[model samples]
Target chain A: MATELIKTRKLAVGYGPRGKVLQGIDFTIERGDFLGVMGPNGSGKTTLLKTLLGLLKPLSGTIETHAGGGGRPLFGYVPQRESLDTHYPLTALEVALMGRFGRIGMLRGPKKADYQLAHACLKQTGMDARANKPYRALSGGQKQRVLIARALASEPEILLLDEPTNGMDVSSEKAIMELLSELQKEKQTTVVFVTHLLHTIERYAHRVALITSDGSLIVGEKSKMLAPDVMARAYKEK
Target chain B: MIELIQVPFMRHILLAGVFVAAGLAPLSVYVVLRRIVFVGAAVAEVASAAVALAVLFQLAPFPIALALTVTSFLALSRLADSQRLPLESLIGMLYAGGAAASVLLITKAPRGEANILNILFGNILTVPATLLWAMAGVFGALLVFQYVAAKELLISAYDPDMGRTLGIPVRAWNMIFYGAMGVAVAIAIRAVGALLTFTMLVAPGASALCLTGRLNRAFLVALALGVVSAVGGVMLSYQFDLPTGSTIVGLLVVLFAISYGIGQLRSAA
Candidate 1:
């Protein structure tokens, strides 16, 4: 087993005074652990992912991670694509370069190395040819690639991607899954991916955490965790 | 016939027009993008109250006007962040409250009715010497700061979360931006007065956007447009003896209409 990278203890996740959507959830992820958060809609899977990334603070629990080098760990986060408004006056290269911000910090401009990283990430994501294009004009699949490049540019130890295959074609999905698998093998990077694809969960992820509507969390291998009875029971509570 | 543009005060108005072109174009662009033109109206109402208080205490209107504009702007922004109250409601309250206060203050003025109408619409070409110096200093600083921060500002305006993730303190940047806008409005009030000043702030910028459609290039176009309108407006005002700010803004409206027509023609093509 690799060293523990993210450890959350009894983390209860929800918005304020709204009551908890997820309660008494505990887990620790190690390097090389591909964890998939699986649940039905409004089952707190997304909220759990958000809680892990510190997007939303847990009402009652502790989430301790060794991110950043003495700063909050810079995780390459692929947020929900639907949440962003892509109609601004930015090019693909400029948007990709934003990922270097955690490394660069405020006030100071992007440096040579930052551009190099952005360029490299774009190449890796097959978005280099469209670097100068307006971001809003890109297709949904291309937009997803740009976002993935942004995450890669951050040089994060862990990648937290939300629905990485939402708008992707089958070939693109295969390409992405292969790339991610290769990245995990080469760098031992831990990925906490949130998706609803049962095949993807069975094929790519090493472990799965199933979140239920009543705030129950189940964590184990795919065979044990993805049984129809287990999934039905997991999603049955509302 | 006297050459008004040749005179220092007329030159100051031209120069101040040039200064406003730097920030107002992008400010207008963002306003249209963020769907927050109502914020501009809110600031204007708050500034009106400050204008009233300035007249009542016999205080110089510039400093007090600027302070009130920034304070109220910051308060509104914070209130927006907290979602404490709906923004439209707050703007309404500010408008009604300020109008009420100013009316009360204007009623108590020792002299006969201060021509509040003049303040509603500015007379730009008649700027005083001290006000000229203040415009030069403030406008110069904004120009340099904006040039350096332009890239970051453009990014933040579109995707604030992306900027935050990238380590741009977008909240702090926003405060600086709106505060600077308030300062610009205050500087404008010295000559054009409060109500009419939005013309200088909004018109040149809007026209530039309609014509060019690119952010950096739009600044140059807006600056040129502002100067042409001011210089041309002053000439017309001198010829007809009309209100200077009205003439300038009127010219701006004409230019905007023409530009909008041309833009539609181009886009349709």
Candidate 2:
């Protein structure tokens, strides 16, 4: 019985009033829960993630995020890799160091301790050797790993990733899944991974939230949710 | 080159050039990263318009120009944050409007046409000591601000979505960066001229980014390129009797091309 980290009750997320893209998103994530959110294109998976991260206002309902010892439940968000422009002159270490910016606060920069933590995070992701490499030079898998490392550097109680394995090769996808599994169990950190990969949701996720085209959400244990009938019901709506 | 430095006016002009370039170079990295290079042009136009109006009405120029420039920057930053229109479209509209207003304002001033040419194509050779000191102060302040706020600014510009998730106050950082750019552009237009200020705000950073894959090194390289371009351009212009501002701009373009070529070659290798 782990502590409840995030609990959403009838959550409605959208761009503005009257523009609700997702509603009735009732779910509870406990400490160390690896939850996978599965949905088709335009199924509001991203909207839900954004809402949970507090990046977007919840159109309706309530979201309760239990605070940790630091007085807030810090969240590390790994946005879709496609969303970032890699052509900019930044190194892997530089990207990882971004995690420390919040804790480092204003007027002061990343000091020695911050850099050490960033390096340690990179090591956790097995990206320490390539830390000096330009971000653009890394392979897609490597880039994702670096991004996850960035998220880890923040020492969040919960990590949220959007489409983390999209476009990755089978080996890369498996590697990412394994790394995420190890991270969750080792750190007791809750993870909300958003993707459309059915096999990954069935295999890696402890719990699954399936969103339908009609804004319906079904959440259950992975084994029950991935049962043929439930998946069909989740995807069949138009 | 050394002979030119012997002249007091030339010395003041060169120092002014260095200050303007150094102040604006580091900022240009964010300008390029955020894809707001055109916003620099629009802000310069607004500064120019303010300057022409101040001169025409016998009001103080720098204060008026700086005020209007900063206000316009804030407005543009807000518009950009809203995501209503594409940033390019907003910047383009502002550029055209500011350009037209600047032309109209300059035409109505006492000694109108001459003032227009001077504002559009400034005389760095005649930089006043007071103006040089002003540039030094502004440049120093910008350097110090960047030193303290570089990481936060970098995080905000690199991936604002990530910044927002971390509760990094992305909007506030955007405002601060734009505010600094406004001051830099306004101060630069006095010596670098309205037309050349955009180049100073973009070229050095672009060139340095082309040459380096690290942000810290890029900043250092940008500052060096800016100083070199200013010093080298002034000497070349003096030696060839070329227009100082345009000469410096041409030199920066050449440096950018060279850097691009080198960067491409390195990537290929």
Candidate 3:
């Protein structure tokens, strides 16, 4: 039996007053659920993710988290690899270590345990060999993997990703999906996978949410959501 | 070389240079990462405006300048997240407004233009002992704050979105970072003038970044570069009777150009 981790009730999210992109969003994510969020450009997929992560305020309604003593959940976010400036002077290990900052707290440096945990995260991501390599030096797939490791290093119960496979080749995308699948299977980590790729969602995601341009959603199991009619309905809702 | 330090005025200038270099150089690393290089200039402009205002009104310059710079920094920090207005426009607007305010205020005060010019182009040699002590005390506190909060500051700067998700109070941290910057700008303006203070905030860190891809090492290198430029520029100015602030700024510019050239070659090779 899966425990409910997060729920949204009649939710509305966007920028400020004039920037309402999505509204009336209602979804329940169980612990260890692989939620694939699909939407076209400007379809408010990222806005939904941001709202769920509590990075952006919902215009209305509510998103309740049950992760910590039935309070706000600690989230690990894997933003688009492109979101980071590659030119930044950081190593993969250093990047991974950043995840621990939340746990380690401020007013002090990282302890020995933090470094060990960061290395373990890097190793899990198959990046321990290149841990010392500068972040900018990594390939697209390697960067994505390191970013995932960074997120995992936080030891979050729920992980949210935005376009994790945006500019990758076929194998890289496949590798990332497989990694996510393994994490879900082994750790029962709740994952929110946001992307535009339909086939990947159909293959790896247990559930899929297709957001229409008009801020509506069609959500269900991948088999149901990825059907031809359902997909076409989602696409033609502009 | 020995004679330069023998004079009390020159000794005060060197100490002031040390304080500015030690304080601003380490802080510049974040400035480079945050890509708010010109925020220093904007803050300096506000400081200059405040100084002119103080002079015109017969009020205290340091306190007024610091207060105005800190206020501007707070405004900038709040505007940093606004999607409606680009940050550059706001900074540019502040820069223009401050410069114009300084000119306007100067026009109404006796011997104001000359005094304003002096504020704009600082005379490091004339730094008072009291101001030197003040620089040391304020900058020392700032350095400690930065040291204790280095990791948090780094995460907040490099990826603020991630910082927020990780429960880092990014806005508060940003305010702290900018507050330190305002204080640095306020202090350095008296020693190196507005233009050189801006240059110090940007150039050393930029040059260090070009030379290395390691963060801690980059910091040390930047600090070293800042000290070298500060001490070297002052010595050169003393020897050649050139403007001290401009000379230091010139050295930093030269170092940046050289580092960039070397970086390009390294990448190409």
Best by DockQ: 3
Q: What are the models' TM-scores?
A: 0.86, 0.95, 0.97
Clashing pairs in 3: none
Off by over 4 Å in 1: A68-71, A167-182, A196-204, B83-93, B104-116, B203-224, B235-242, B258-269
lDDT of each prediction vs. the true structure? 0.72, 0.85, 0.87
Considering every candidate listed, which one attains the maximal TM-score?
Answer: 3
**In candidate 1, residue A123 scores what lDDT?**
90
lDDT of 3 by residue, A128-168 (tens): 99999999999999999999999999999899999988888
Q: Show model 2 residue runs off by greater than 4 Å.
A: B55-58, B103-110
Model 1 chain B scores worst on lDDT over the 10 consecutive residues at B110-119
Q: Score the docking of each candidate (DockQ).
A: 0.33, 0.77, 0.84
Docking class of 3: high
- On the 0 to 100 scale, the lDDT of residue A44 in model 1 is 78
Residue A135 CA error for candidate 3 (Å)? 0.3
Question: What lDDT tens digits, residue by residue, belong to model 1 across residues B46-106?
Answer: 6666777877788876677789888877676555545346667876777787677768877
**Tens digit per residue, CA lDDT, model 2, B103-177:** 888878886557656666776877788878988998989989988888778877788888987878988988888
**Model 2: lDDT of residue B124:** 81
